[model samples]
Target chain A: MVGIDEQDVVARPGGAASPRRVQRVPMGLMIPAAAGLAFLVLPLAGLLIRAPWTTLPRRLTEPGVLTALRLSLQTATTATGVCLVLGVPLAWLLARVEFPGRRLVRALVTVPLVLPPVVGGVALLLAFGRNGLIGRWLDSTFGFTLPFTTAGVVVAEAFVAMPFLVIAVEGALRGADIRYEEAAATLGSDRWTTFIRVTLPLVAPGIAAGALLCWARALGEFGATITFAGNFPGRTQTMPLAVYLALETDLQAAIVLSLILLIVSVAILALLRDRWLTAP
Target chain B: MIEGMRRPGPVVDAHIVVDRGTFRLDIRLRIESGEVVGLLGPNGAGKTTALRALAGLQPLTAGHVTLAGGDVDRPERRTWTPAERRPIGVVFQDYLLFPHLTAQDNVAFGPRRHGVDRRSARQLAADWLERVGLADRARLKPRQLSGGQAQRVALARALAVHPELLLLDEPLAALDARTRLDTRAALHRHLAEHPGASLLVTHDPLDALVLADRLVIVEAGHVVQEGDAATITAQPRTDYVARLVGLNLYRGTADGQTVRVGPDLALAVDDPLHGDAFVAFPPSAVALHSSRPHGSPRNTWPATITGLQRNGDNLRVQLAGPIGVAADVTPAAAANLELAPGQPVWVAVKATQTRAYPADVQPSAMTRDAR
Candidate 1:
């Protein structure tokens, strides 16, 4: 019942003495914060500074490099599209509904976010590989094997990236006002109509941001793509796969590939960020 | 009653009965075409629940809801209409305008969903915007509109569908005082023109008196009183309703025009004949005198001021004595008498102005069942 001002001790004690000595500095807070900031930026800075300069154009213009980039864009875009179709509804269920195992369901959705991409790829293979449980039946009944194909690359990327969209969209759905839905209902609109007309528009910004995150994650996916789809030129090979393969033979080529990926991603993100902020 | 209401218009005949935990909502109401009934109640009094049930958002534990002569909800037959299919419109307490859509688009949304073509829907939306006097603001998003303007747009959205029934939930509660007054007058005019059966749920007594043909007062999910404002205000059956109507009410034994209140206090009235009767009057009816008056028509008593609150330009002084009552007096008068909490004063009411009636005016069976 007491007001906000009465509860703030810091605001009440305005006469506290200022630190006058260097020894009074608190390293417990400052040291870890600075170290954490550097730890994240240093690796990115290292990539930019160490990239190859000589023969860079020849490396970039190589048919194999262009093929990998094309494959990467195609698979990542497909993965992002799949995520949008499934993740939005899943996020809605998580944010709005109360069902048995809801908590378990939410936790399970985030497993890919926490699990190593290689482990996720292994799990997918176990579930969908030829001779696997459902995979064997699919192969026998439909001859639709999924592994070692471009489709497999998309599946792996989507698996590793979907959690980003689900988590972000769900948070936004929860934060958005639910009264608007009720209002829509009162205005003679049904649940689905309310969602399409009101809920989706209100949460468009969050969904766009989530989509960008999913796309970026899909674009950079390496371990899952390699483990599930393997490395094949013009088929399953993507930019990350090309970078990894080059690392084995030519570290300089790998650095150049890494730099290309970095610059392209930065450009795309900068262009899309404004659109995301202004979404519906 | 069912067969008689076959006209192509609103004729809502509903007896809504619902039990939420220990609270129960039981009300029988009827609204003919072009009628506006105000459902008035305090918070948690099931006003919203009744409105929701009418809108098919809440299921009734018992009773039936009929709109435009069709059975919307009948628990016995296990029939219920979903909110979407029901030809009813509701204006929510908070105008839930779609934040992304412009005001025109938001108003057009319902019409488009109901199968009106896009261009026509927009045209209808524009027409409704003008009806609510917001034509220039049609292109603005909901966030950009003022609260009153948004509320008007919400009303227009509900009206655009030409629903058989219209429901408004605390329509003015979200507005500032100045906006509320203006909006209330405008809403009154709109409701007057609306041909459908309109149900307005509000806790504000002034809104009920000003805009409704009849008042239905609910408390703790049950209809406590229902009548024209004057009847309910004059003969409130419960203490809650009495307080809302701003009357000091007491029930006791009455011998002729004189009613025995406490052991020592007997209120003298001009009305004759009584036994087990009630006496009711407003705080403004009581007059505070400097001392016990020698007048033959005034029933005076020595009282102590218990509390004081501002009521318009005067101070509403709560007095405690053999017969407790409230009196409104000017601050200057209060200061002249040197009035303060616990200050002794004399209060009186004209014998001719005092009203006394049968205390059994409220049926005990209903009261006991009500509790």
Candidate 2:
């Protein structure tokens, strides 16, 4: 039997009793906690175990692999930038302003988060494809069509990823103390100036966290990009789409691609943990 | 234009009326330049509502606000000035200094917003910090400063804009007792030097007495009393103000030297008045006795001790009878009398110690003439 001293574990700074203390784990809770950890970690462990390690370096250098990886990175970053430009103000309006039907509008903004990605892709295509509602006007007036293009991939990714950014930024805006804005007004700062100077800086951390989440979601997007952009090798194929195509003919290549995505995302998320993840 | 000539009109004159739900606040205020008026009230007495209305943060439901002889808000005329455009500065109760900016930048924020160049704005901020005696701590953030230092920084930030009117809400309420004393003295000096009109809101009587030139006491949503500190202290009309100033107040009808305080209790006050009046004296003036003593004291009443507590070095006993009164006695005297709750005792006060004044004079009418 292993015995632990409660006093040693409960020792706090300044010798004061901490309101929240980590107690010795009971078997009732310990079993489920370990099982939950295993449930999340086992799949990543299996990916590493089944990876074709010997051929990974050569497979990673393949032109198709590099093109897909590069497209995924470029499209995800651009989509995140688009989300930041459009979602931040929406979040601000939702958080700060009072208007009729605001609750309904907020619910509509979050529709993509719960909607099937394939449906969202279909919705985007119906809106922006050639001969589609808005797409026909664009094609007739400016000779522009978004379907089967790189820009379509970015549009689809942003459509699916924007809800994350808006939700995070709006929560940040809500949590910020509004009295500082009042103070700014008393100091002769108008509404726009106050928003740019005081409101933006206060919610910067939330925006950063939201943008990271959005970029990660965009990178993983497959169904929407495939449905809306129509996979062509270099023009529209992203990593997830290439991984899907590779799975039909070459299982090893698919495993290698999946391993790459997993490794890169895990590394990036680990690096960002100290920054946005730990913030209150 | 002569140096000694008085200004023609007040810097701020306003009548503010705000209605919210079932509560309504109506107040009229006028302040000349270089005068600090303290709005003193209890928790839900509309002091903050009046302050916000003056700052243009809240609109008046009726009436108008004129600052420096210019109309700022007039609900009847459909004219209203937003808070940002008004030439006013406010130090909020918590001193909401921008947490992300350093003290210097926070102080410079107002001037920069008013179109001052960055270099000159920084210079102005430095000068204001120096004036507040926090020049050495200008580079520190608000969280790094102590409560007193944060208050001084807030003051500097408000004054850097060079506003024509200044408003403070419970400026010293956030500080510890020791820090409040020091900060209050410093604030008094700055207010004396300020050339603009200032309005301060506080519930503490000490803050009003020590920092303000005049006090407007609000109860519920209206002004119950407004006078200089000496006048208010000497005579408080409402029971609230009486308790605030620590006086035993009673309303009665006076006939010559005798005043009927209750149905059976008539206090012998040394005043010659005939109509309805009020009599007031300090608790220290009341003498407690175990039995009726033969003496030259003119007033005496049988009272039952209801409660007793330590008041400074003496014990204050609350007694209930025909007229409720408080008597302060030394602890030794209390022990000798064997005083306890529900003990019967006799209370007396000399006729010369009590003051009688006419009661029918309304405070609102008095405030207009006093101002």
Candidate 3:
């Protein structure tokens, strides 16, 4: 088949550079793919080219820089931990259950995936803020407030990023061969045991991929963190917020902060991806 | 109180009653321990449905399934054990082995799920692998194993559970000819050693004949015939079962010695019968000649050779004339007669050789037929 296609290409005018070969690629397919590739790669390339290489060491070692970086790492990791605990079961339910309004429920889970991060922060505030529904009751009853705190930052990041994990893991669950679960059942394993031993192990790669996606998305989240947790230095000022703050006063500092986040997220994703995602 | 009776072996006493659309399955069977029962049927003949019902994979619409005196399903009492809880093992047609696990781990799964510790479960799986003669291939995953080897691993995995009843659904159907022969021999040995009542569901007659002690022919979800191997082969109840037993069967009305088989053929049988009846004679019992033979065989008619093929060493000539039938003769005999498609020939069926029975046996007569 390869030889035949190559021969056909050779027979055509202009040989391999023939327009007919490229014409087979539909405009519908080419346009969107070109746009998507540019959208993903251009910003990364822009960051790398504009990074403050001479001031990199000084800016990276700044006291506030370390504090914001540490806080960002801590919050993102904690958010990912929360997602793994709650998102996996929710994903399994969405993928496997056949109840009424399941499609609506699935759409609701992915609402955060498509929603603007600021809107998600507002929604979270309305539900869990100081004067909001549960927040108001908690403030009156226990003198507790979930806004403008590091824990609040974690909650905001988790709310925005958990959908990525859930959707990815749910897709994996949907594609997985459910016969293995049935086979496990026939082997005398109950529903919970089969889910833990057979179903979970089979979809571990998917869970890892999703967790990485969630962590990266959370690390870069700005709107929700600044709105819900209120960007106080070293408290709610995650990497993206710090970069945004530096954007107004000093463009070079903004580029440096963006470069730091870019480097950290890319390095972490690459290392973990090789360790878990690419493996069997 | 003093007991004077001795205990018999475990027998699978099951009453399967299910309603699946237009087809209804109503079958009661008692498969003796250490005996292999073949549930033989056509594609839509509900053979697998019966097996699933017994295995607790499908719930019964009514009736009860008791394995060795333990009730597995009773719709009346709303007592139904799930498939995993039932002490029954199944070798599905595709094997359904866990592709991610090694052969040993796949076999160990059942034992591990049954609460055996890791070390003991692995040991049990190793023993089963050794028994199946695949101990050296234990570390190989299911994708690496051959078709026959995968089937054996599936069987070993099922047997590792030490089930009270074993159900094999087309265990050898997935294998090629040579593989099937070897797998059949291995399966026969394993089933012989297994002290549990086993039900082997297959449409292949050779698999039933070779691996099962009793033959139960189901048609459209009902047991058409159930007896020992010889009884089923000798006295097939339905035309489908008759074909499975390699008999050319025709349903006709019998009047004295002459039975009008088709529009042109009236075969004279030795068995006296009246009203509706069935006539059966094996292909080997039929003799084909170029001309009418001067023999004592009263059933002789002209036929056209419609098709011819080799059955074993003999040539099976499919004749179409007064009645459609297949006659097996030596290749030399066929050559001597110059047999070919569209050739004219005289067919003879011996009177004493033909067996005629009622179209449907009475319930009382079934007991006598069992003998």
Candidate 4:
């Protein structure tokens, strides 16, 4: 029976069923596919096998560990909120409006996605640091600075995570039927109200998926947060930053933090898979 | 000037002109209150563009649109009313009900936007749903509703706004044949009761005949003909309209009772009109013969059958000769005659069966004359 099941699985190429015959997979493809699966799974298995399981609970409860984890969660959530408020409208503008330089603007929006996180950190510092252009004016006028603060961690994370949210939401907006918007207009609803009532509800799933991805990206942010916010124990040091700092002094603690981050990320992705990843 | 000032025109009066790339649309229309005007046209004939321009969705490059004595769109004056501000409601071709909202919420959306309180908006939605006979299905999503039910909900949603002018774009085109009959009857009743002026755009002649008080036929972005259903069916001006009304049309020079349809073909019509004239007769009036027979009919011509198709219970044979014509024959008669494509046949019609009227130069006629 097991052999038959294995044969059945191997016979179905791309899950296509034939009326009278079953297709067989080529050995060349099967070997590489198995190797690819092992390539992805083996590193994760090693992490689990080498984890200091007995000291997990105690290490998790440590003041530094809890503080860093708490900061990471709070900042990631705050960054996601910021992305939602600003990114949704920007996505709408890029998707719906026609104007000069729109293509250039859209290309600029994706720059952060390709730019290295440490480079993004440097760019953010140049724009929002104490001695930077806007930062100097803000310091002189409002006596406030963003770099090396808890708020700076959120800023860096949002800078790195916003592109994912914008790209996803914009795709949803483009795919949505614009005729519904026209119908709403004919029903006496203005553009703004139509957007809020009709357009937003239609694209809610896309926004949710984008927000989840944005939050996940923000949670795993390390180089930008450390470079711009300067890793401080309770204020700016998030889980990834903490892992990096612990790698020098305590390998077990570093492994524990890494495990926690991996578990949270995987749980979120698993929870969202059924609703979003499999959507038509 | 005094007489013109005193004369009251239609509630909606407009001359709409739009330019898109190489295509230009110029159509003049007027609709009195409580009247339903159907804009019937073939595909890509600018019927939807005219509807969109009236709804303020498409901007006019030239001309103006006046609704209820107010200038809604006048490009010369730089005066334009946005679609939301215009007192018009449109039923899109696909019905376009919001997929995410329930039927009740979808209907209530307009009322809420116009500043009705939540309770009253829901109440208004309930009343409208009841009017459309869908109150029981108010909680269902759009996907849950049948096509006819969705169309009704769309109509109710548009009417809830209490617009001065209503536009329906191929309202019954999306329905199946069986559903269309029922939905058409329901729609005709609603249109009769509506107090506002309405413009319906459709390609189906039957829908226009049943639902419209007036029919305006457009072709190639121009208004080719406009009249009541009976007048349009009885006397079509263009070949497009003639084909739509199911008539074989011919343009020729008339002398006394005979109209020369072609160089060698002359049709004996009843009307004794002079100069350019049009002769029209139904395919059913045409009789096919295997050989020329001595008959009282004066309009007989030898023709070759080009095509044959089952039309209703009879076969409609397309004949091409000096004057192209369609002749309907019973299946037994067709079999007896052995009618098929490339078959030579003689066609005849009675003088009294053909109607003749003075012809006006039209775009289609001009092109045919050029050829």
Top DockQ model: 2
Top-down lDDT ranking: 4, 2, 3, 1
Summarize candidate 3's per-residue lDDT along A67-173 as a digit string, tens digits. 88999999999999999999999999998888999999889999998899899899889988998999999899999888899989999999999999999899889
**Candidate 1, lDDT over the whole model:** 0.87
lDDT of candidate 2 over B265-368, digit per residue (tens): 99998878988998999999999999996788889989999999999999989999999998899999999999999999999999999988888887653457
lDDT of 1 by residue, A1-280 (tens): 4677577755654545535434655889989999999999899999977877777888889898889999999999999999999999999999999999999999999999999999988988998899778789889999998899999999999999999999999999998998788767756677888888889988988988899899999999999989999999899999999999999999988898899899978976886767764554
Binned by DockQ into CAPRI classes (incorrect, acceptable, medium, high), candidate 3 is medium
After superposing candidate 1 on the true structure, give the runs of residues whose Cα lies further than 4 Å from its correct spot.
A1-25, A53-58, A263-280, B1-10, B290-293, B362-371
Over 4 Å off, model 2:
A1-37, A267-273, B1-8, B363-371
TM-score-better candidate, 1 vs 4:
4
Write one digit per residue (lDDT tens) for candidate 4, span A46-109. 8899999998899999999999999999999999999999999999999999999999999999
- Tens-place lDDT per residue, model 4, B250-366, is 989999999999999999999899989989999999999999958698899999999999999999899999988988899999999998899998999999999998886543422
TM-scores, in order shown?
0.89, 0.92, 0.84, 0.93
> What's each prediction's clash count?
2, 0, 0, 0
Candidate whose TM-score is highest: 4
Cα displacement (angstroms), candidate 1, residue A136, comes to 3.3
Error of 1 at B204 (Å): 0.9
* Candidate 1 lDDT score at position A25: 54
Candidate 4 vs. true structure, TM-score: 0.93
Weakest 10 consecutive residues of candidate 3 chain A by summed lDDT = A14-23
Clashing residue pairs for model 4:
none
DockQ of each: 0.58, 0.75, 0.51, 0.74
Comparing 2 with 4 on TM-score, the higher-scoring candidate is 4
